[model samples]
Target: MIELRGVHKAFGANQVLRGVDLVVPRGESMVVIGGSGTGKSVALKCILGLVHPDAGTILVDGQDVTGTDRESFLARFGMLFQGGALFDSLSVWQNVAFRLQRGAQRRSPVQAREIAVEKLRRVGLKPEVADLYPAELSGGMQKRVGLARAIADDPEIIFFDEPTTGLDPIMAGVINELIREIVVEMGATAMTITHDMTSVRAIADNVAMLHDGVIKWTGPVARMDASGDPYLDQFIHGRAEGPIEAVR
Candidate 1:
C-alpha cells in the first residue's frame, strides 16, 4: 500500500536516509526499528509530507506522494506522534476530535464528540475522561487519547511513532495490544517506529531494522531471533558490545 524508493534526505553537511527503500503491503503492519538520530522519524515525516525529501519518490497506493495536493493526500492516513502532541487547552474529547471539528472538512460538534467517545472506548478510555483536560490525565492516558484521535476518522493507513513510550511496562503492553486490535479491526495498513520490543512483538507482522541510513534487515517477526543479522541481534538483545557503534 505504501512504497519508498531511493529516498534521501540531508541536513546541511550531514546525510540521513541515504537511499532508503521500503514497502508495506495492504493490511500489513511493518515496524521500523533503529537507534536515535538514524532518520527513522524523518522517514515518517517524509511520508506524512511534514518533511520534504531532497531526493527520491514516496508512493501511496501506487501514486507518487511527492508534490501531490497535500490536503487530499493527507486525508488518507492518520498519525500519532511520540509525544502525544495534544493541545493543553482542549478537553480530551476536543483533542481527539480536532481534525473532525476544524478546517474545510468539518463534522458536526455532536457527531464529532460521538466519534471521539467511540474511539476513546476503542483505545480503552472510559467515557468519564472525555471532559478532562490533558493536564488532568497521566502520561499513559494522554498516549491513549492520542491513539484514539489517530483512529477517529478510521483512515486506511496509520503511523505510530513510539506508541509505547513513557508508560509502565503493563500499561505499555495494554496500549500495544490495543493498537494491534484496532489495526486488525479496521483492516488498515500500519507503520510504526519504536524501540520497545514488546510493542514490536505485539503489533508487527514484519520487522525492518534501519542502520546507517539504510535497511539492515527485513524479516517476519517470527524469524527475528534466527535472522543471523548481527545488527538485528545487537538491537533486539540490547547488547552494547555488538556491531552497533556507541559514541563516547
Candidate 2:
C-alpha cells in the first residue's frame, strides 16, 4: 500500500535519512525499529509529506504522494501520536470526533458524538468517559482515547508513533493488543515506529531496522532473532555490547 524508494533527507549539516527504501503491503502491519535519532520518524513524516525529501519518491497505492491532493491524501490516514496529544480544552467525545466534525466527511455534532462513543467502546472505553476531559483520564485511558480518535474516521492507513511510550508494562501490553486487534478488524495498513522490543513483537508482522540513515535489515518478524544481522540482533536483544553504540 505504501512504498519509499531511494529517499534522502537532511537538515543542513546533519543528514538523517539516506536512501531509505521500504514497502508496506495492504492489510498488513509493518514496524520500523531503531534507536533514537535513526530517522524512523523522519521517514514517516516524509511519507506523510510533512517533511519533503531532498531526493527520491514515496508512493501510496501507486500514486506519488507529492502529486496527491493534500486534504484528500490526509483524509485516508490516521495517526496515534507518541504523546496522547489530546486537546485539553475539548471534552473526550469532541477529541475523538475531531476529524468527523470537520472536512470532507463532516457529520452533525450529534452524529459525531455517537460515532465517538462507539469508537471509544471499541477501544474498551466506557461511554460515560466521553464527557470527561483529557486531563482527568489516566495515562492508559488517555492512550486509549487517542486510539479511539485514530480509528474514528475508519481510516485506511494508520500510523502508530511510539504507542506504548508512557504506560506500565501491563497497560502497554493492553494498548499493543488493542492496536493489533483493531488493525486486523479494520483490515487497515499499519506502520509503527518504536524502540520497544515488546511492542515490536506484539505489533509487527514484518520488521525493518533503520540505522545510520538507511535500512540496515528487513524481514519477517518471525525471522528477527535468527536473521544473523548484527544491528537487528543488538537492537532486539537490548545488548550494550554490539554494533549499536549506546548513548552515554
Candidate 3:
C-alpha cells in the first residue's frame, strides 16, 4: 500500500536517489536490495518522511506521506533498525514496550509489560528474559528483542532496516525466518532494505534492485533469478565483474 513515483533526492552535488519508482502492495513483503551507497536507505527514509524528496511523490494507501499528521501517521508504522538499537539502561520488557508506554498507544505499565511478554514470546524469548538488560543478551536474542518491539504496538506497517546484519549465518537464518513468520502472522505491509540475498530470499514476496540510485529491476521473487537484468544478476551472484563496478 505504498508507492513512490519518480522520487528524487540529493545532498548538494551528491545525488542519492535519482528518480526512484517503487511500489509495495498491502500485506506483502517487499525487499529492496543494493550495495552500499546505492540509495536504498535514502529511499526508505523518504517513504517514512524522515527525508523529504526534492521531486516526485510518496504515497501510503493513496495519501501523500508529506501531508499526514506526524504522530498519528507514524503510529501506523513500526521499525526494526539495522543494529539492535536497544537502550543499555532499559530492561528487555521496557525496550519492547517503548512505544506502548508513550504517544497515542500509551498503556498502563502493567498492561505494557503484559503485551511485551506476549510479543517476546512470539519472538521466542521467555518472560524471565524481560528482566535482563540488552547487554545480557546474545546478538540473536537482541535482534529478536528488536523484532518484538517492532510488533508490540500491532502496527499495520513495518520497516526492517538490514534485518540480518551483524549476525552469523545460522543466526541470520533464524532472524530471517522470524521476520517472514511475523509479517505473515501480522498481515502487515513490510518494506525491508537489505543487501543480504539470504534475507531477500527468505523474506521477500517481491524484490526491487536499487543500483546507481535507481531501481534496476522489480518483480516477484520467483522471477528474480530469470529476470536477466545485469544489475540484479551481479548483486545476487556477488560477481566481481558486472555492470556494478566493485571498488578496488
Which scores better on TM-score, 1 or 2?
2
Query: Ranking under lDDT, best-scoring first?
Result: 2, 3, 1
User: What is the number of residue pairs that collide in model 1?
Assistant: 0
lDDT of 1 by residue, 38-142 (tens): 999999999998889999999999999976888888887888889899999999999999889986879999999999999998888999999999999999999
What does each candidate score in C-alpha RMSD? 1.2, 1.0, 1.1
Q: Give candidate 2's whole-model lDDT.
A: 0.96
lDDT of 2 by residue, 59-87 (tens): 99999999989999999999998888999
Give lDDT for model 3.
0.93
Error of 1 at 59 (Å): 0.5
Q: What clash pairs does model 3 have?
A: none
Per-residue lDDT over 44-158 for candidate 3, one digit per residue giving the tens place of the 0 to 100 score: 9898888999999999999999998988889999989888899999999999999999986599999999999999999999999999999999988999999999999999999
Error of 2 at 10 (Å): 1.0
Candidate 2 wrong stretches, greater than 4 Å: none
